[model samples]
Target chain A: MIGDKIQEMFLENQENFLIPAREVAHVQAENNLNHALLVLTKIGFNVIVVLDKEARVSGLISIPLIIEAITGVTEIHFDRLDSLTVGEVMRTDFAVLNDDYELEDLLHLLVDNAFICIVDNEKKFQGIVTRREILKSVNHVAHEFEHRYDVQLHQESIFQ
Target chain B: MIGDKIQEMFLENQENFLIPAREVAHVQAENNLNHALLVLTKIGFNVIVVLDKEARVSGLISIPLIIEAITGVTEIHFDRLDSLTVGEVMRTDFAVLNDDYELEDLLHLLVDNAFICIVDNEKKFQGIVTRREILKSVNHVAHEFEHRYDVQLHQESIFQ
Candidate 1:
């Protein structure tokens, strides 16, 4: 039943989101940032979504990589833009959630990761989800719930 | 008064959207696909939104661009791929509309190009708008309309 709700939620807001999978692909952390840049250049939008060994969500590869790369880092002790690894700059503080969680929880967590990476217990990169999707899904579910409740209440009042 | 509505509409959907100036700036375009690739890679995924010179919304610079670029017409004829401009492979058929269009009109045009490029009469890319934003606006507007009409109807019925 919950899984059914999940699918329903996904459909209601499918158009509302520009998912990462739709936007870009997940790259291995071991890959060099320069290599990711080269590969990502061909990918169109330059975001390197990092995936862990389990393939679950890891971190974001952002434009800052290029900004840092080209302009180099200012805060570094060295007077040089040392080539940063995906590890050096990737945002690991990103938020992630399981699909099983209530859509409400997802909506709140979505504030962190631009896109939430959906994963199984195995931690494999299952699919990404976004705030738009969650909101859309929640709206649909609320509407459906209201309609169902309305009908039920009407029948009860008539009986009463 | 109209300004209020326009601002209201934009303000309403601000929550659902990541309305940052930095979003997708790197990958946006409406010309040669090859050139788009170059620009997008340089910019990276702030989720660059593509626009035509007149500034009409063209299509989004997606991660798939890189994936597609690796093959976007290249597989069939690699030589010609380089010759292509952002316009050739650029997504031309869009579901774009002016900011003045009613939310209902937009929902009806959800044919393709999920994101609408909000443009001026000259058709320059002003901002990338999304269904997610419109829905919130429409819902708020509908509630306001309903409340006003409900009050009016209540007064008229008492007179009757």
Candidate 2:
């Protein structure tokens, strides 16, 4: 029964695992980097996805990029920090997963990324899957196992 | 009692909270970017600390950095990937926490950083405290409260 429960939680359909994009932190490519960083900080996300003019996936900006800008490591002119847009500072290299992606494949992407960006068939920006969310799901399933294990032990003791 | 537990976990002495440097993924400054990325992938870390010639903390190379390097967005020459070293692309701007740092201060840092580097006053690399580890600790404490609440509810129902 515990094995079945594990299968139900872990091996379930992909639709149940999709974290809605509304729960993720994202910024438009046209937005100022300064404003994006401010909003990103408030959201407490390690990385913020950048969406294009049509709300499609574009790139990502993270705390490290902010630090680089602050340290003058990047070519961003200090005086233009107020005007620099997300498109100029965000790294365009990122993996975009479709709605049909398997949880197993998503786990592989999470191994190298802080979060995975999901998009629809039309390239509409959707929600992201974060390691924290996945871990939270795991902890919930673990509690179920713990509860069932206690009941099993109780029944065994009564029979003895 | 929950407040006391929070205090015990969050306000306790710093020594108990150290995650140990050996547990972190690190690369030498002179190591090639190709090799560094390979090790980083194998270790499944979002970021890898770059150590200098004297084995002292130098900078950090994260997944985003690797992504940038691959995309040729950074100043690093794409043709020199094999010859390029971690030192060429690592971010020198990083916050280092000493052993005496308060958990509150560490939490503040972790709000934006995936992990905070810990070092001795001599600047010797210690370990890193990841957000994942802190969340896991919090979850453990939360379960205790949940168990107590459940038992209380059970007893009240029996009395009724």
Candidate 3:
């Protein structure tokens, strides 16, 4: 019964779980690795969205990708950071969700990914759903049920 | 009633959720940033543990920290990767859990962290509890509940 309730709650609040695209940090595909690294450092995020000229979701870029790009068989080529663009090394094989995606789809994807990009039918970026948001929502729901049922599910405070 | 059962299940299976330290990637404090980068690139982990000479958990290292160490006010110091040691740049302000840690503690911490290092009283590394593991466990429980109750809580397959 509680499982069904949680499923319903997740489905009903699907829209609220999304971190809108406007609030997410992103870089243009043409930007060099150096610029991408700067964006990652500035925003304190492990990965950032890469957008093409038309504002479509191009790929995802992260520090590991940059490191891999610069690393040679014998040594790291620091100069490549300036020469290589995000488009050249960004990861294209990432998961994306449509507007009609289910909460179960998100839960399954978030198990392997830190976040999932939400795109429209035209592959235009809409927003992101992060593991943190989902965890927070779960914690919130647990607390809500605790209050309604007058029971203790956990002793810890709500996740911030 | 179901909330209580779920809590009991989580607590009873706490140890199963941990990813033992031996499976985790790590670097020594004496290692240079270049070596750290190599380990990260090789292991496909965003962050790696840093150990002191005594094999105690010293800190955590990641690409952002490396980038920050190499970044100057006006330029990026590419040469610092060779010059700086992991000890000079690794982040010390990370969460660590002991063997007696509760499931609630892990769930609360995993909301903000990708993984929480498990350490002994002597600060020796024991294992790690990852967000992935928690998600998998939660999914497993949902499926178990679905099967027992003979209800269709979700339409999707179990998360891998």
Q: How would you encode candidate 2's per-residue C-alpha lDDT over B1-160 as one tens digit per residue?
A: 1123233533333344567877777898889776675665456455788987665789998645754554432232335557777888899998778866765566656645777888888888888877666655444433332332221123334466
Taking the candidates in order, what DockQ does each have? 0.07, 0.05, 0.23
Give the range of the ten consecutive residues with the poorest summed lDDT in model 1 chain B: B145-154
TM-score of chain B of 3: 0.83
Better-scoring candidate (TM-score), 2 or 3: 3
Instruction: Quote each prediction's TM-score.
Output: 0.51, 0.47, 0.86
**Residue-by-residue lDDT tens digits, candidate 3, B1-160:** 2255456644555667788878888899999998998999877788999987777899999988888889898578888899999999999999898888866677788888988999898888988888887777666554444333333223232221
lDDT of 1 by residue, B20-85 (tens): 333536344435554554455455433356654544466655435433544433232334435655
User: Candidate 1, which CAPRI tier?
Assistant: incorrect
Model 1, which residues run further than 4 Å from truth? A1-25, A38-48, A54-56, A62-84, A111-113, A119-126, A131-160, B1-90, B104-114, B120-126, B131-160
Q: Could you tell me how far off, in angstroms, the CA of residue B16 lies in candidate 2 after the best superposition? A: 6.8
Give the Å error, residue B54, model 1: 5.2
Chain A TM-scores, candidates in order: 0.58, 0.72, 0.83
Q: Candidate 3: list runs displaced more than 4 Å.
A: A1-3, A11-16, A143-160, B11-15, B146-160
Question: lDDT at A10 for candidate 3?
Answer: 48
State what share of the real interface contacts each candidate retains: 0.03, 0.00, 0.30
Tens digit per residue, CA lDDT, model 3, A1-160? 2366557654555667788989999999889998998889777778999988777888999988888899889788888889999999999988899978877777888889889999999888989988888877666554443333332233232231
The order of the candidates by lDDT, greatest first, is 3, 2, 1
Report how closely model 3 matches the true complex, as a DockQ value: 0.23
